[model samples]
Target: MTAIHDVAIIGGGLVGASLAIALEGSGLDVAMVEAAPAGAMPAVFDERNLSFAEATVNALAALGVMQRLRAPTGAIVRIHASRRGDFGRVLLEAAEHGREAFGQVVVARDFGEALEARLSGVAGLVRHRGTRFTGFGAVGDGCRVLELAGEGPPRMRARLVVAADGATSGVRDALGIGASRHDYGQVLMVARLRAARAPDGTAYERLGDDGPTALLPRGDRAWGLVHGVAAADAEAVKALDETGFLARVQDAFGWRVGRLLSVGPRSAYPAVAVRAAALAATRAVLVGNAAQSIHPVGAQGFNLGLRDALTLAGLLVACARRGGDPGEASLLSAYVARREEDRRRTLEFSDGLARITANPGHAASLLRSAGLVALAALPSLRAGLVGGAMGYRGDVPDACRSGAAR
Candidate 1:
């Protein structure tokens, strides 16, 4: 017999875990499937940080995770963007945007711990860590029957199966949703290092002909560096000794952050923008990186994913309150419609910025520089850009505004 659930989330990473917490008291049986073993889950090796937009912070606060996060976090009060060897520059100041800070930064471990802790006490939630979803079948009333290799033939059923499994989602593949994939042929080298000069809560983005280098403030005399490098050189860079890697990074970043003293082991991520054909189908939906994975130029990936999760959760809860099946066509369509504009605009903005900045010729550089200058000089234009960066988009759910997961 199939043990039914209102929602069966196919990934238990940050997004999946947060979704579980959001639907806790809404009278829905929620279950999360994490592929890796409970003990083998990914952990932060070093000082990995995530920039949470103002709306995202408020959303997480509303979900009850922000209050649980400890101190030592950094808030991004200003963001600086400019192209190397060009006079084009744009700065986003929180005061100009009428925000205390564009967003707050938290270490990956801190955010993960807070999410896991809050999920622990959510009633009617089942977390199947160390389990993978082998297959699923369309069943009665638009519900799906999920197959797993755990305890028994529990045959879990769900009105909506959210595939938050990530960029390479098996659940998404099984659902026959094809994505438009653009492999930028670049790898993002991310690391933590001590800076010779202290960061005054300012994030710096230097656009290089090859790729972009971003320095995000992390308190305690450290900063997070995300450097984009050619795919062919990714392995070589990662294999380089500390001194060699820092030398390469310094060449790209220049003296923006004073100097790079020491760097921890670096992590690399391939850059790509994937847009699924559809976010919702008959009985299943996708969110987070599984739904749309964009380049990390603006740190828009996770923030966008969180917003998707929030919208889907809110729609589900609203449907449940109205005695409607969350997986029904009307419910699913509503979610897809709500998220369409934001997803399109974000993907375009990230992709366009990456392409424009990557052109090696002088003409492209001039155009981009002029655009930046124009954006910086105009108040309304600057406001629009900052709003987009701060996670404001179409039809945001109330939860996002408060940073609440629930």
Candidate 2:
């Protein structure tokens, strides 16, 4: 007989793994469906640097994932924002907000390793690694039969299914859920760069004609470089030698982080904004990139997705406590309602930033400079911006509020 799980999460990437960790010891039988093999890292977790919001850091700590990390993390004590050829700049400090740090940066591989380590110790959690979610069928009231493509049992019943399968989610497609996609006509090339000066917990974002270039501090006195290039220029940019690339980056970013010493392996991907038509349907719901994939202008993608996982976990725990069906329409409705504000606000913020800064006109540049000045000069505006950056703009979840997992 196929074992039934209280909740089966599709996609074991950051968001999906996070959801699994958040629900630990919640008295609900949970299963994670992953296409990758156990202990193997996904391509998404290689070399890329992830910036965690303060709320996300707390949530990860509460889930016990932070303690398991083997790689060193860089704290973001301040943010320096500027526009190329603009006189005005904005500096946001954690100290001003009475916080130790606005966020922390971690290499994706390190975080993946931490999540894998924590997953091994979670009791009552089943991991179906190397298994792909093919589709699903209505089994009975408050449950659905999940079909899999792998060596194990082909089908299992799940009371609730959470889709965290990323932007191109198969489960979402199978469900006939439509997504609106907007291509930004830009590609972001990412690499690890060494700088002359040691990192002092400062992150930099420079806006120019090409696009926004971000330098996020990492361990080992290096920085994670995200250089956005126009679609037509992506190939030429990739073809540049290390020295040429460094020169181009220096020209775009100015002398913010001292001299660039060296660069590691590089990877590039096209940027697109995708949002699902609906967040929930029947016994399944979308979370993270599966529900919406926003541009990484403000580094809000994963932070927002982590919030999704945390909020859903809280709702599931509450449902389990009350002996209510996990897949009940009421539960899904409540989950959507709770998350609506945060999701909308984050999507708008990220999309707006991407659009406004991409324009190269003098008027646009002046507007950008004025906005930065406002953020630095106006206490009310600064507070609201900092609050959103720290991931504190929406309904707070218990899992994120507690210092440690219950």
> Top TM-score: which candidate number?
2
lDDT of 1 by residue, 1-406 (tens): 6778888998888788778888878987788887656654444313466888887888888888887777477789999998888886888889876777898877777787787778778888887877778887666855789988764344678888999988888888988899889988899888887778887889889988668898888755588888989989889888999989899888888897777889987888888888898897678999998999898888888889988898889888888899888788887888889999889899889999898888888898778878988988899998888888888887877876664344
The all-Cα superposition gives candidate 1 an RMSD in Å to the true structure of 1.9
Per-candidate TM-scores read 0.95, 0.97
- How big is the RMSD of model 2? 1.3
Q: What ranges in model 1 sit over 4 Å off? A: 43-47, 150-154, 403-406
TM-score of 2: 0.97
Give all candidates' CA lDDT scores.
Answer: 0.83, 0.89
In candidate 1, position 212 carries an lDDT of 89
